[model samples]
Target: MGIQRRRSWRFILLFFPLLVFLPLLFSVSELHRNSKELDQDLGSKRSNKFDHIVLGPAAGEGLSNRLQCSGLEALNKTHLSHISHAFNCSEIISFVTVFAVYNSSQSDEKLSDLVTVGNNSYSKAARSMAILNTYINFIQVSMPKSNVIVLSDPASELLIRRNNVSLLHIQGDYSRGMLMLQRIKSYIAFLETRYEEHLQGKHHLNHYIFTDSDMAVVDGLCDMFHKYPDFHLALTFRNNKDQPLNSGFIAVRGTPDGLQKAKIFLQEVLEAYSSKYMKASRMLGDQLALYWVIKSHPSFDVKRFSRPEAFMNEIHGAQVLFLPCAIYNWTPPEGAGQFHGMPLDVKVVHFKGSRKRLMLESWNFFSSSGSDISDMLCLILKSGRTKYDF
Candidate 1:
């Protein structure tokens, strides 16, 4: 009886505190659950109220940390010097962002629908400019020393002038297939002009990145050149089977030999764009042109054994490197989860089609002055407003 009594006493002692605190713990847990529910309700309300703009998945996670401008030197292990090294300040690659603000007719015809976000209705031109402004702002903050060029028509020039982004005036119907061909011609001419200056010792080796205006750069690009130093041209590919290559983002090395190689590869692409497939109007866009050129190459064979697997083939004596679209030219769906890698590792985000609104929203959300988004858009969309310095 004594032993049993002692055992019972020990059991009571062991469970006494739990008995006393069990109700308190449950009450605290319920309180927390209620608080979490309230926060979610508030968040949903805010989202509906600001449905005017598209927000990134990381809107609340703070995108300022993803800028990566401050970590350039540390990441590249170079002082960003203007010397003869890769990605030098002087021999830097120029980033080319293209947009079509007006049609070929020179009338006030709208190319895209006027997007009504919140209380403001933005014209196609205004939306294009706003996205371009976001891109320029990103480049200025992330790559101040690198050159940025805008390739568009005269109508676009006027809208672009407000931001002081370098303009490459192109004249023509700013439509799809036509614009793609014009981009090739204009880019070739620009390269030739720079090459001529290089012969006169007026320029160093030139390089360029052709990208869409609706894209944003989260990481510095020095690593790309350094990692793929051997290739003259690099193309990014999507997961689509029919139109796998994405021509929106291309990296070109402008050394004399590199230029020759790129010219050969691009010439093939240009010819393919005009081929019978394109004439049949079988959706033969630039992406299709790239696909045909790549697939038709004599040395093209799928070698799937390599790590970070990519397609590499010889094109008319030039080495062409094909990169995955996930890392280079990400076109993720709206409201998708976070990227696969670290945010700083994500080089570019192509906010194509309707997702262009996300660029504006992301800029506003990440900018130091978050509330100035409408004010900034007004400066672009309306007149008689002070220019917002990019």
Candidate 2:
């Protein structure tokens, strides 16, 4: 009887371990199955979300059909396909200029008053036309081989005429305050369209440079492209102490990562504008949205130019290269003895603030032959304004 009891105890000890382990083994199997199912579900949901955001709900549609329906295939074939990538600055970069012109009936009294040039009271649309014309003329003289694309309303198309330049009429209400955020959206759309064109074997563009209509190119930007080969995006610093970066002048490279960053920037701006909390905190505009984007993205290869005397002052991600403001984005300061003529080194002039009134004056001065540029530079250097000038 004692021997029989010993055998039974041994059996109990062995079975006891099995009993404890069986439940745990089954539980672990169940958890693994559930985890796999959960991952699949989440992945599907994420895919759907991405589709809705990028393709406008009809994500199943074929690429060719969408391109054909959107009339982008023709554009791609015409503008993108034939271009070659030879590492030449002109071949790699295209200058994109945007303008929103309003007629007398659409513009307010303030805009109307601002439009008047000298003795003639021109419409706001006419003034914008003049500004764009001057810019185009300057670009032609300075960078004849450079590619230019102008985005404007249909009405303003009549004013711009250049054989080498491409004109795209973007239909939208670009009134001063209404749909202000849409400007950035439009820019993203244009960039994406170009990207698609590149993917379709139509064109090969490495970079896009964006500027406002009031801005004019005084020199070729080939050196800048050669200088920053790795940077994905370049931004000019705003003159305002509160706003450090200006979206007015942006140079973005054509890469998957760069495009994705731009999309994120635009999305964040849209979300911030829509958010009630953020809307109340600050003035909701493209500049503010850009500020948020730059601050949010610390990893991006963003180059900021932030010298007080430089045209672009502060970049968010990288060190400042200190490009001369007298050449890049020369915004003339206010005060007596301020030089109004274009300096030799000035590449582009961005007319901002009350100094925007000087756009017409500068445009006329630069277009004419009689202005003494040397004397103007002397006056600007003598006046204390050039120290902190934008």
- Measured by TM-score, the strongest candidate is 1
lDDT of 1 by residue, 1-390 (tens): 999999999999999999999999999999999999999999876454222442222221234433122211122112223122223444477888666665434332463445554344666446656777778876664566677887777655354453436777766556665776766666666666666676678877768888877777654667667777889888876556567677788888878777667766777877887773455332346677777888776777533212334566676777887876656776544212223322333456766654566566556644644422222222111111111111
Give lDDT tens digits, candidate 2, residues 1-390: 999999999999989989999999999999999999999999876444110101111111233311111211121112111112222345456778776765556444554244444444555446556767766765665566666787766655355467778888776656555445556656767877766776687766566778776676655676776666555566665334446555567777667655555555556666655552234332346667666655565453333423334322223333323344445666555311124333344456666543333455444543463433232222222222222111
The C-alpha lDDT values of all candidates are 0.60, 0.53
Given candidate 1, what's the lDDT at residue 161?
Answer: 56
Pick the lDDT winner.
Answer: 1
How many angstroms is residue 322 displaced in model 1 relative to the true structure, after the best TM-score fit?
2.0
Candidate 1 residue 355 Cα shift, in angstroms, is 0.3
